[model samples]
Target: MTAEIFATTPEGDTVEIVTLQNGPATARVMTWGATLQDFRLDGTPHSLVLGSPVFEPYRSRMRNYGAVVGRAANRIAGGRAPLNGATVQLETNEAGRTAIHGGSDGCGYVNWSLASHSETSATFTITLADGQAGYPGNLALTATYSLDDEGALTLEITGTTDAPTFCNIAHHSYWNLDGTPTLGGHTMHIDADSYLAVDEHKIPQGGPQPVAGTRFDFRQPRAITTPQDDPKLDHNFCLRLPGTEMHPACTLRAGDLQLEIDTTEPGLQVYDGSGLNSEVPGHGGVPYGPHGGVAIEPQKWPDAPNHPDYPQITLNPGETYRQVSRFHVTRI
Candidate 1:
């Protein structure tokens, strides 16, 4: 493990970036948010995911670029949910209307501790106190990133809370397999027949909607964007209810490079990066703008706490919450 001090937070917390390698793949992970700062595969000329060389952008403009965002990965209606027979009000970070990504002080924005590491794997841990972020529980969370001999990257996250609370985490990485200015030539395929419908506020309305005959259909590999693309996606594609076994969720391809994602989660959130205009540059000083990359996040359904019909997001005491996801790239 090659580790170095990345930066210090204003709170006087130290952050470190660690490098792990196996076979043809190398991943640089940081303690802040347990982020995957950069990922590179041998023979590839550029990073597969968008990132920054310095920590300033990550702390400011590019908060979620390559971090594990959570407590609750997506939105919660009105920032309120019923927990343990009582209603709990969470921090409404999104427009002061909804709780998005566990509120403003979410795990993604906080500094974590480097627990352990090997040459090809690293684990980061953080603890959220009871009543913090308006959630009940003293939750201990761990995020581990590992690489296999075949260059596949695996992310395993686990949470155990002293009290019942909500726990849904997602890796937020904006991927651009070709290093292009935009996702013009990228094609994607998601193994989902339906997706959640959202309101104007981007909150789930009710049940799942069929993807057939809709622009949301990506059953077969298709270009991420066309000139006539409508309803820029920031929605979740329903995979299945949470399960113990991992399943293939999606695949993304650009030219000869391909990325395959498998996860144990139930939903895949596909954000087209339509809102990603940033003055701060990305890795290698690359300018990030609309369609600069696409974020494919696997997690539990959004607003699960409010919708009893949706997959549940509650983590009770003595029960361990676990999510496993793998990202493998190959020359296609």
Candidate 2:
């Protein structure tokens, strides 16, 4: 359990990587944006290491932009929120009118206060003022990360709001199990039978649809980039089952290492890292071109607040909001 002040860039900024070696598992954590730079499971490497120049093309303008996403983790259709019967407007960062992950200076960009840090764990907290990002209430959000003896990396996100508001948070990690040049060889298996289809704007269209014969089906283990559509999986899956109780969400294997992603979130957004602009740079001096890694983002459905048919994300005063997503890796 030792954290290192890794090499710095010409930006005159210091990037710290937290390392934790527990039994057969090792993790490298970065503070540039509070991201998981690398994780080796049972001697098999995962996570796309960060290089000198970090490039985020697809999400380039803001790829791995924030250490943690906030206020709302996903998109907010029309950038509107209904709190206490009052509609509040939010910042829209996308090209069109739709709001994607809060805006440029949204939660993802804010430098969170490091509440606590240790060899095997770290905790970060940030307080959101009322009307921050055009949302409803003042929010106090906290995220904690811990690695257990079983080699499971558990992320716990808890939030409390003084007023009615929608709060969602998550850890955006790009996992490449083979520790190779890319994530093409990594295989995936998702325990989902349907998904939320979206329109051109990438907004949820209707309700859940079956994945029995569709390309979105991941019930069987298959290469993450099997089809020519590597780095093209930008969709939300309607998990077969939803609950607060922990369950197997998805399993990924790279080379001889295997990872089981478990979460209590209702939906999982699979963004194949298709859009990494050259500006963000890459890890280990390698280029983060399309499909450099895969982001299995588990959380409430995107734009859940706008869809009445979808699950609601409203949290009022006195209601404790909690979410847990874990990546447990082991040797095959």
Candidate 3:
């Protein structure tokens, strides 16, 4: 692993970017948000993920790009959820109606400490105080990124809380395999039969709904395009109930390159970057607009705390929250 000071945060904290290489892949990870700043293959000409060259954009216009999001990832309706027999109110960062990615100052916007590093791996750790962002418990979180010889990037996240609280973290990386301005021609396949139905506020309205006979279906490889009237892609595809074994989640292909993802989480959120509009240029001077990339996030179901039927996200004092996801790319 090679490390360097990337930039300094507004609070005078120095941010470091660690570059890890193994076999045919290379990834640049920064301490800010425990973000994966860049990722590339040996034969690829451009970075596989979208990122900014400077730190200012990450803090301003591109906060979620390649970042580890959450104390709780995704949306919570009305910024409220039932916890320990009481309603806990959280920071409503999304238009004052929804709590997104653990609120406005969630884990993705915080600077994490580099806990350890090696030639092909790095681990970052952060601690969230009890009641921070209106959530209970003092939570200790760790994110470890490792590369294997077969060009697989594995992310393992573990969390422990001192009190009962919600904990669902996810690695948020926007992928653009062709280095194009949009995902116009990319094809995707997800191993899911149902998806959550949401309301105008992007909060789940009910339980999981079957994807058959709907535009949400992607069981077979299909083009990742949306018409003007089609609903934008930003829903969680339910894989199964939370389990310990890793399972194949999805796959994305662009010409000769394909990315395969496997994870232990029960749901995979596929955002088609319809809301992406960045003022700053991405890596390699790529302009970012709608559908510039797609974010495939593996985590527990969104708003799990409010829905009794969904997989519970409550983390107790003695239990540890763990999620392992692997992304492997190949020339197909």
Candidate 2: which stretches are off by over 4 Å? 3-17, 30-33, 45-62, 227-231, 242-244, 278-281
In TM-score terms, candidate 3 sits at: 0.98
- Runs off by more than 4 Å, candidate 3: 240-244
How do all the candidates rank in terms of lDDT, highest first? 1, 3, 2
As for candidate 3, its clashing pairs are: 1-119
The lDDT per prediction is: 0.93, 0.71, 0.92
- TM-score to true structure, per model: 0.98, 0.87, 0.98
Better of 2 and 3 by lDDT: 3
**Lowest summed-lDDT stretch of 10 residues in model 3?**
239-248
lDDT at residue 186 of model 3 (Cα atoms): 92
Candidate 1 residue pairs in backbone clash: none
Error of 2 at 233 (Å): 1.6
How many pairs of residues collide in each model?
0, 25, 1
Model 1, residue 307: what's the lDDT? 91
Per-residue accuracy of model 1 over 278-327 as CA lDDT, tens digit each: 67888858669999999999999999988999889999999999999999
